[model samples]
Target: MCQLLGLNCATPTDASFSFTGFCQRGGATDHHADGWGIAFFEGRGLRLFVDHQCAAESRMAEFLRSYPLKSRNIIAHVRKATIGDVRLENAHPFSRELWGRHWVFAHNGDLKDYQPRLHSQFQPVGTTDSERAFCWLMQELAKSHAGLPSVEELTLTLRELLPQVRRFGSINFLLSNGDALWAHCSTKLHYLVRQHPFTQATLMDQDWTVNFAELNQPGDRAAVIVTTPLTRNEQWTAFEPDELKVFVDGLPVEVA
Candidate 1:
């Protein structure tokens, strides 16, 4: 299994605080040490990074610990290889183009005998089941919708497709285009929203603290979703076993 991290914000925001804790699970606090990757959406472009080394030991992850690459939507993953070898190409947080927009995906669980036919346009470069699932998803989305479909329609399609995906194994994941972020939970997922009147928070996995009131503006709003709670003080809400959520502009929106 792997760990997932996501961010959706009203304004461009950095993920150093949450990422610090998330990185700890890569090899320090937990055992998901196969590989790790992250993607940050910047307008129409994306900043993507991946490494096959353990995030806790990788210098790349250390750089991300302090780097404040701001973005409106972000997806990250720390992998523990279950279906693929420990290689750079096997890392999570894979990306591809869809409907003229870049879409990023990361998986936290394994699938058993879950191969699906894929078109040549979106074939996976990696052998991991996570990447295969991502390609399948993009393939279906492309075949079903010529371009970006309505949010409701996308959600409905996702809800219908999720059950078939679950037949393989746990399918918790984070997905995003530049505009919005989507999260699906099969076992564990938690999230917190920070907005105006935000309070001080402390990381559960690291000895760090942040007073949101001092750094955030009155209009700033952010939603962070993770496989586990990232902070010790904030009241993180846990998603149900089979729940799916969509975040738009750093806020959770209705899902059918």
Candidate 2:
């Protein structure tokens, strides 16, 4: 299985703090170290980086940890190599274009013998069940709407489409289109929102503590989603099995 991390913020924010702890899981603090990648959405433009190297040891990951590139939406993944080769193409979070917007997705669970009919321009470039699932979902979404639908409408379509894939196996995943981030829990996932009156928090994987209240403005807010809780002090809410939720402006919204 892989691990996923996503950030949706009220304003452009750098992921260095969260990613520093996350990349540790790729090889140092945990065992999912086949490869790792990340995506950042800057308005209509996107920056994507994928590498067939452990995030803990990769120079690219370290550079990102030191550089402060801000984005309103971001997605990252550390692979464990269950269904794919340990190559660059197999790294996530995968990116594709739909309705003139860049869509990013990353999966955390393995699907057993699951394959769907992919049509149009949606096709898998890597021999991974996760990429196949992403392509199929994109294919179906393209068919469901003539153009990009509203977040609420897209969520509805996803709710109908995901169950079809869930029947095969666990489908825990994170998806974003620079508008909102959608997260589904097939097994384990936790998320927390950091907003007004922030407090100091320490990383679980490293002896790093930061007082976010000092770094962020009063109007700043961010939602952090991960396969496991990353902070030792922050309150994290676990997602219920089969639950799908959307986050916008660093907060979860009710979407039917």
Candidate 3:
């Protein structure tokens, strides 16, 4: 199994705080240390980093913890390598281009004997089931619409397609395209939204705290999703089993 983390914001925001705490689970506080990767979406471009080393000890992860790269959408994963080899290419948070927009995906669970036919343009570069699933999702989306569809429309399509894959195994995942974040949960997932009248929050996995009121403006808002609660002080809502939700502008939007 693995761990997932996602951030969506109304304004460009740095995920260093959340990422630092999440990285601890890679080896220090937890044991999903086979590999780790992250993707940040800046406008239409994407900055991706992957490493085969444990995130808790990787020099690259340490640099990322210090570097404040701001993005409206971000997805990260710490892997335990159930379905793939422990290599850079097999890391989660895989990226691809769809309708000329860069899309990022990360999975937290494994699939058994799950190999979907990928005859379209999208293909996996690695042997991970997670990558294969991502390519297949992109391939199907490309076929369903001539171009990028509305968030609502995309949600409908995903709701229809995801169950087919989930039948094979757990399919908890996070996906984003710099516009909105789509999260699907088969077992465990939680989310929190930080907005006006922000309060102080403490990390669950580390001895760290942050006062949102002091660091953010009144208009600033952010939505965070993870496989488990990341903060000890914040109220995190657990997603219902087999639930799919879409987040836009730092808030959950009804996509029916």
Candidate 4:
């Protein structure tokens, strides 16, 4: 299994704080240490970084923790190999282009004997089931609509489509396209939102504290979703099994 982390923000924001604690799970504080990757969406452009090395020990991960790359929608993962070899290509947080927009996906669960026919333009370059599943989702989305649909419309389509794959095994995942972020839970997931009147927070894995009120503006807001709670003081809400949620501008939106 792997660990997932996502941030959907009202304004462009850096993830160094949450990432510090989350990356520790790659080898230091937890067991998902095979490989790790992250994706940052800036406007219509995307930045992706991946490594086959354990995030806790990788120099690349350490450098990233110091770089303050800001993005509105971001997805990251620390993987523990279950289906593919420990290689760079098999890392999570896979990326693809759809309707002229870059889409990023990361998964924390494994699928058993689940292979969907991908006869469309989308195809997996990696042998991991996570990439295969992402390609299939993009393929089906292409067939369902002529172009990118509204976020709500896409949510409706996903709700109908996930069951087809979930029957095979756990499918907890995070997906984003620089605008809105979506999360689906099969067994484990948690989320929390930070907004106005922010408070001090402490990391669970590291011995550091940050007073967000001193760092964030009144208008700043963010919605963070992960496989586990990243902070010790934040009120994180656990997702029920088989639940799906979408966040836009740092807040969960209702989909009717």
Stretches of candidate 2 off by over 4 Å are: none
**TM-score for each candidate, following the candidate numbering:** 0.97, 0.99, 0.99, 0.99
**lDDT per residue, candidate 1, 74-177, as tens digits?**
99999989998999999978999888889999998879998978865889898988888888888888878878987777877788778878989989999998
Tell me the spans in candidate 4 whose CA falls farther than 4 Å from its real position: none
lDDT of each: 0.91, 0.94, 0.94, 0.94
lDDT tens string, model 2, 125-234?
A: 99999999999999999999999889999999999999999988998899999999999999999999999899999999999999999999999999999999999999
Angstrom error of the Cα, residue 104, model 2: value is 0.5
What candidate 1 gets wrong by more than 4 Å, as runs, is none
The C-alpha stretches of model 3 lying farther than 4 A from their native spots are none
Scored against the true structure, residue 93 in model 1 reaches a CA lDDT of 89
Worst 10 residues of 1 by lDDT: 150-159
Residue pairs with clashing backbones, model 1: none
Q: Model 4 — TM-score against the truth? A: 0.99
